[model samples]
Target: MDTPQPKQLSPRRRRALIFASLAVAVIVGTSLYYLHPIGILAPKATAQAASTTLFSKPDTLVSYNFESAQLGWALAVTETRLNQGPFWIFRTVDGAKHWQRQLVGQTSSLFLTLASFQFLDPTHGFVAVGNPISLYRTTDGGMHWLALGLPYADGYAVTFTDPLHGWFLAWPHLWSTSDGGNTWNQLPDPPVDSTPLFLEFDKWNNLVFRSRLEGWLGSNGAGQPHVYSSADGGHSWQRREVPLPSGAVASGTLRTGVQALPGAGVIASVNPSTSPNALFTSFDGGTSWSEVTPLPIGGGTGDLGFQDNLHWWEIYVGALYMSSDGGQTWNHISDELPSAVSSLHILDSQHAWAQMFFAEGSVLAFTADGGLHWTRANAPQPT
Candidate 1:
């Protein structure tokens, strides 16, 4: 038989067909972005990567670190429940106007698993993920990451002073890396007494390194607050006896957190679950701590953020306080915070970011002009 010409649709029919095809494409693209399948979908952290397209905004923030008022990163999960699965590392270069997904973690366990991250600067960063944790290092500001071996399956925190010098803490054991994070060396067992009675090092305690050779580890929760100084790059540690305020007896479980200050000192806040909290300072790099001021407010537990020894801030029980003279005195800034604040970062006396948690969801708050005023930054919004 001879070849026959095919029939063509009319103008109206053609328009309908085109619209139908476009609708289908839109639906498929949205489904893929929203119902992101675990392990199958991973975002490329490139300069040209589209922001807020490949993944969902964080349901809750796990941890966050800001190198400056404009540059920062947050470790958050899409699920409301923390242990459900799928964690993401988001970087905001324009002061939280937009956040780019730098990393994704596939971790869904029956038990709760936590993720911790640290950025030595705006460029070099490290993240510890999964229940039996996996460590990754990014030298180019999360544009790329290389997996690093961990000495232990479970680790609570990671701190890097420089690209070459870093430390990882897995409760009683600590590990160090001198050549970036390519290899790890198990350091001398942490001082027996430095370990907290109930290990929540990832939450209340912190591991901070001031330089390649000097670092401090704060052990708190369910015991007398303890601070240990590691002078030889975490190879050895010594307990820095943190004395209580004069005639201030400990009543409840005291929690302590130490922040390596800007120039030459360390700042610590010893907050108790009960009343009568205290703040301490160390001009000698945590070797000796003297009570700076008896905290005027007391509560369940709070967080401390420092721009330097001279400028510090604290968020406790949904209220904000600032100290102009290095934690000696405080002025209540605002009580309008929704709830608990985590990832409290102070870039300067004026610029800062904090993730505030409430009953419905979490919001990222930014402050300018020394926290006298605050505004909600453009965090990821659920589609």
Candidate 2:
């Protein structure tokens, strides 16, 4: 591979914005700005690595999903400067000690995960790549990919209920993929505002659907953000009212992020434009909500992994915190990870994987013994 040289002002400017904050003002989910390349500056230093550094260079890792400590998958986006380049699909069978890179597709977003990507398992995955947008699928793990049968992507977000059922979101445009991601049939778009904008990180990265019959989508363009509820998948949606925080108004710059657990209630967090934010949990879908606890503004809201009302991990600026007994109690983990924590997928009370984000590179961290210890994982190789 050739050394990455700074590309154009367009890609660099966009990339810088994506790494700065997960701030999206768009109502519909499509308000995203893709950033690729190092631009004229080098990588920023924020988080720290283990005594045993995961990678010698600056390649980064993203812990998307995991089956076990021995088998997992992540995204490996290399730091580049010249033109948009191919990113990697990272897979590990024996934890993070060793890693293999499978080149996927050329990207315009340094933060490609925002460009819409997902893997149902080690065998089936989808990635939207290049401009005018295209979707690619990998069935035999990350070994190879085949172009998906779709119309146009222009950057899309995809989610899978299983290896066979899935949904694709590109804001006003939505599609359903029954046989994994091989092919998609366009569906009726969600009822959103006429104006179309991009979101850096509004609430959830994409639409959160607990089941085919139940899901939640966000709209935040006119003034404040609103959560849309769907009883019959994306076929139709209606506004789900939420209890606002002390300083939040029904409409303004207020935004809420929602996550639904398998056996637990739907939990959502609200960040107001002016006042302190609060976390809320709804046992009956999103129709009615109650406040759980007040939240401390952290390093970043990149990764707010909530296992239940009590068990979850969140970051602030750079500090990491964990809660075991829902939100009634809390513990400060550390503030020197490297960058803001983006994604934290906790397997049990003890083991989990996390990804940190910066401008030029991304990083990975994992803990086998709960919050007692953490190990910096691996980065991609300079190909």
In the order shown, the candidates' Cα RMSDs to the true structure are 15.3, 9.1
The digit string of per-residue lDDT tens for model 1 on 1-383 reads: 01121233343533332222111110000111121212222354353322442212324434557788788876655443433455666678887778776666554321122334668787888765544555667777776777667787655456677889878777778888889878888888776555533323233345677899888876554555667787798887776756664555566566666667788788666766654556678888566777776346753336677787788788775577888887667888876554443446788767887765433344567888776666776555322
Question: Model 1, clash count?
Answer: 1
Inter-residue clash pairs, candidate 1: 350-370
TM-score of each: 0.74, 0.74
Model 1 lDDT, full chain set: 0.60
Question: Candidate 2, which ten residues in sequence have the lowest lDDT sum?
Answer: 39-48
lDDT of each: 0.60, 0.56
Residue runs of model 1 more than 4 Å from their true location after superposition:
1-59, 78-84, 108-115, 197-204, 219-226, 246-257, 269-275, 285-288, 294-302, 316-320, 332-343, 381-383
lDDT for 249 (candidate 2) = 67
Candidate 1 RMSD computed on C-alpha atoms after optimal superposition onto the true structure: 15.3
Distance from true location, Cα of 98 in model 2, Å: 1.4
Using lDDT as the measure, the top candidate is: 1
